[model samples]
Target: MNDNDKQQGPDNGGSNPWMKNLLIWVGIFLALAVFVTIFNGPAQPAATSTIAYSAFLDKVEAGNVRDVNVAGEVISGTLKDGSKFRTYAMVQDPELTPSLRKNGVVITAKPEDGPPIWQYLLMQSLPFLLMLGLAFFILRQMQKNSGSGAMGFGKSRAKMLTQREGKVTFDDVAGIDEAREELQEIVEFLKDPTKFARLGGKIPKGALLVGSPGTGKTLLARAIAGEAGVPFFTISGSDFVEMFVGVGASRVRDMFEQAKKSAPCIVFIDEIDAVGRHRGAGLGNGNDEREQTLNQLLVEMDGFEANEGIIIIAATNRPDVLDPALLRPGRFDRRVTVPLPDIEGRVKIIEVHMKKVPIAPDVDARTIARGTPGMSGADLANLVNEAALMAARLGKRLVAMAQFETAKDRVIMGTEWKSLVMTDDEKRMTAYHEAGHALVRIHEPASDPIHKATIIPRGGALGMVVSLPERDSYSYHRDKMYADLATVMGGRVAEQLIFGYDKVSSGASGDIKQATKLARAMVMQWGMSDKLGPLQYEEQQGETFLGYSQTQRHNMSNETALMIDSEIRALVDGGLARATEVLTKHIDQLHLIAGALLEYETLTGDEIKRLASGQDIGRIDSDMKGPSVPAGGTSIPKTRRPKGPFGSPAPQGA
Candidate 1:
């Protein structure tokens, strides 16, 4: 038989064979008992005779007799005291006749001769037969305990998948072009081992797939196995460990042996870091068990003999925490990183997942990909399924673009908080707060384009202004950084501009924290402050308990720390001043947008643009219906100082 038949045979060998044998043995034993009972009929008398004695007073009793025989129910016999006893016709009552009560009679007589030799032998061997049966039972139990029993604990837990079982090929995995290309070579090597060996080249000992969870590392490994048409042994690292001490090492050895036997095989270990954590890193009496397992794994990976035709592939998100020995050149050899997909990669992933789904013609995967920047392949798949489910819930025949959009919003934010209660004053404050962000983004030329603004509460946010880049960008410029900071501070600036020092809520806590971090990084880390002299004041110090220490702490004096703090504060103050000036100039337009927001509860970027430009509020244009803007129209400008910091240009728009 082929390898597939062999693997399947072993999987079913233990239980199926045992059951068949057990049933056959049980049938045999039952048949033997039945045959023995049928052949061995009721006991028969050798001679007919009768014996009699008084049950109460048996000093002497007499009856007729016949031939002397051991199997006879009644026989000629004499009492031990030399009294005579007839073996037959001793009873006159019908109930006491020999034919009526055959074995019920008790005679106080001894036979002239002892029982027959065969009967004596049968009686003597009873204890030996019982002893033999007991010994057989113990031997059977011992045999069961030796093999296919508790001793089978040393068996490997890896599941063997033959060529026909793992049907997933490289075609199924999408959006990981580079990873796929690298893995394709491994598959080629597995298929044609001699091609690489002829050139004195050694196949990589192992390849570790490093990525965040749900990035399809395991899937890629399976695809490689499918492409190579080899036996795939799939297991997790945790399967190697048990409560016992040596079990994990034994399991590792057994797994490697099995893989070696099944040559041209791929051993896929998911979450390898579970068994390969950094040695001697634990605090309380180092974990000897895990360390032992890791040592065994290292030996198995790179021992005296090279593992030809046997390839090991492991996946882990926490590759950084793995032991250094496992990652050395001769062991893991190669590490492939699978990061979150870019826009194009996300589009490919969406397309791969959407093939099974019935989607509307207008449902654009590219648009969905552009909206979801940091989503992984798994996330895109989930998004597609979620969109399909939303369509089904709405009783649509196919998933539409609107459903995908809603799913994107649900994934980014959360479900709509329709039941959340809010007073009119709170709603107005939220509208103004959101309007502040929108207006600031519109006026700041370097800021990303505003997509939409809403006073409707979602994901616990009372209101939000969504701004997105026209295209996906990898790098951020300094002007964009400054503009982002201005947008972050817009709400506070608007509150101060309109209410003139009225009560301000702590709703901007996250905004303040982010803006502060960015401003501090600009000064101390990025060296945006000219006074700092382009020095990196932030020291990373390699994953310390607390955050990185500032360079000024150890090297500089208290006066220097004071100077650094002052510089940082000055930088942030300048950004806040710019935000204030812009908000103050556009105060009228801000109020108008805020009023419109309070009435409509939501607004697109075009509506805000028209209101800011002092256009009459007549019919809503088609572009204003959504977030689209008029072609070639520039956004409103930020308030600029005329000559110096003292005098500035007044806001021109409504």
Candidate 2:
């Protein structure tokens, strides 16, 4: 198998391969030293002979011929009573002779010869052998520590998927039509390379899949692999980092080399922004390791002589922070945006998941899709699974529409906190607060009608009023902003109208804060304020991290800040007044709705409509029955009107 196909093993404790190999070599040298020492032979003596002076004393004892001649191998002088003699001699049945002429000397014969060949060899080789042993030990340690024998830092960390592993095709991925179309060409290039070559066109070296989390970016990459029928290599950006410097860069090189060997293969890097951040943008001298890795990646993308049929696919949500070099023409040539699925996309996603579930005849995918706006494919899949689980919990044979509806609500709102205890006074106050919002929305000729209202505590709120548009809308006009502000202020206005004072609580704090911010932005930032003229006080770029730094605008007088504040307050006050006016005109209607809420603790949009028309609560006793007629069959007032521009009043009770 190629280096890319080799699965990464656990770290071998050492930071570098040289260190590990150094340790191994040291161990081998030590083992060899112990073996040689155990098997070495014993020492031997030298063969040279020694001279003997005792022969001269023996000749004196023999007393041969008055004076004995002493002849030795190099006698220095004649011996006297107190004199010394220096000579090399050997006693071989020799009689010491004293010279009769002038000086008499006793002589002993001496032998001269060198040591044996074995002794010479031992003396000469001993020092050389010790030096050789020391040299071998040092070399082994150096080799182990240097890691020159192993691939070391150049190993790739990418994961390889073989044919045994299940593949993911386009059929496995649902939703995101635009992204699929963009990636289809990549798959085509991998499947049939000559097709692009014929046109003298090169396949895009890389494609960046940008989206929020759980939008199926990684899944799309796998689908490309399956479509092309090529090997798939997967790794995270974090895998490249190591304690040792330059390891990340080395890993990048190894990964590219592996990809080249397995020609026409895909390399999928998930969350690549972890290591591919913009260079020279970090604090201090900057992260050396990450920068080096990014530099190596640049080389692999466009610096190499040829890519050799290798395609790199990277996924990240924060594409804005990536290095510009990484996104250049020859590198990430195409950027595919995978946004949250719209209504129709959600329907298809739900249908894909529903096939595995036993859905009842009444269950409708389109209805569920409409109910869940701005849901990603992952969210839709979870919804379907949740619905099926709910049906199973109730011991039902199949998933019903009600189950899916309840699942949708559960996903949006928290689970039903039915056991949450509240005093009668608190419940009454909640009813008035929610009724205030409902009544203002229903009465305003420009406000969108309410879809549902409930005083039952759910998802930490004591009450909720859900206002949904009849159809999806993209842009908002001035009147719509005014209507939205009025709806937000309706609760506070109702409290003051009914109780003659405002009792503030944490529940309405978020609403009040959001409404005030929007109003201020409309005046200061959006130039929606009439008195402020057409100046944009705040500049917003729709960045995820908002307001990273403050810029000094051209100095303005204190009067300007005060004027902006006054304009914002004036705008919000107008909305509050409008809400109060609408609620006052329908005060009796508000009381009827609040009374129904106190009894049922919840009410649908239809129930609120009947109550607003002054219909008696006794006539609408059943939940399923249509609005009831009075005992004398009196017709209710048709106060509901069609909505205007900016989500204006759509006629109620339609």
TM-scores of the models, in the given order? 0.73, 0.69
lDDT of 1 by residue, 1-654 (tens): 755676667666575766766775686576556445434643335542344434312322232222222223444443444444444434444444353234333433344555567656655664466567556656656655532224545556888776656578888888888988987888989888888888888888799999988889988999998888778999999988787887788888888888888887899999998899877775436757778888999998886233378888999987767889999998888898877677778888899999999989998888788778778888888898889999999999999998998887778766756655565556656667777888888999999877678766667576778775667687777898888888888877776665557656666766677778887778667777777767766654432233222243347678767777887777667767778888789877887787777655667777788878876434443423544323222243221212222321111110
Model 1: ten consecutive residues of lowest lDDT: 645-654
- Candidate 2: tens digits of C-alpha lDDT, residues 1-654: 533233222233444967766776696677566445434533223432232456545434544323223344443333344334344554433332323232343334344335567656665575666667678766655644433223344477687786457778898788888999889988888878888888788888999999998788998999899888888889999888777889889888888888887778899999998888888776537768889899999988885422267889999998978999999889998899998877778888899899999989998888788777777888888999999999999999999998997787778765755555555556666777788889888876667767678775556576778765655556678888898888888887777787766554344565677678878878776788777788877653422333143423335678988888898888888888998898998887777777666656667777788777865545454543565443223222321222223321111110
Best by TM-score: 1
Residue 273 of model 1, lDDT score? 83
Question: What alpha-carbon RMSD in Å does predicted model 1 have with respect to the real structure?
Answer: 11.1
Model 2: CA > 4 A from native: 1-154, 162-164, 304-307, 445-449, 502-506, 540-557, 615-654
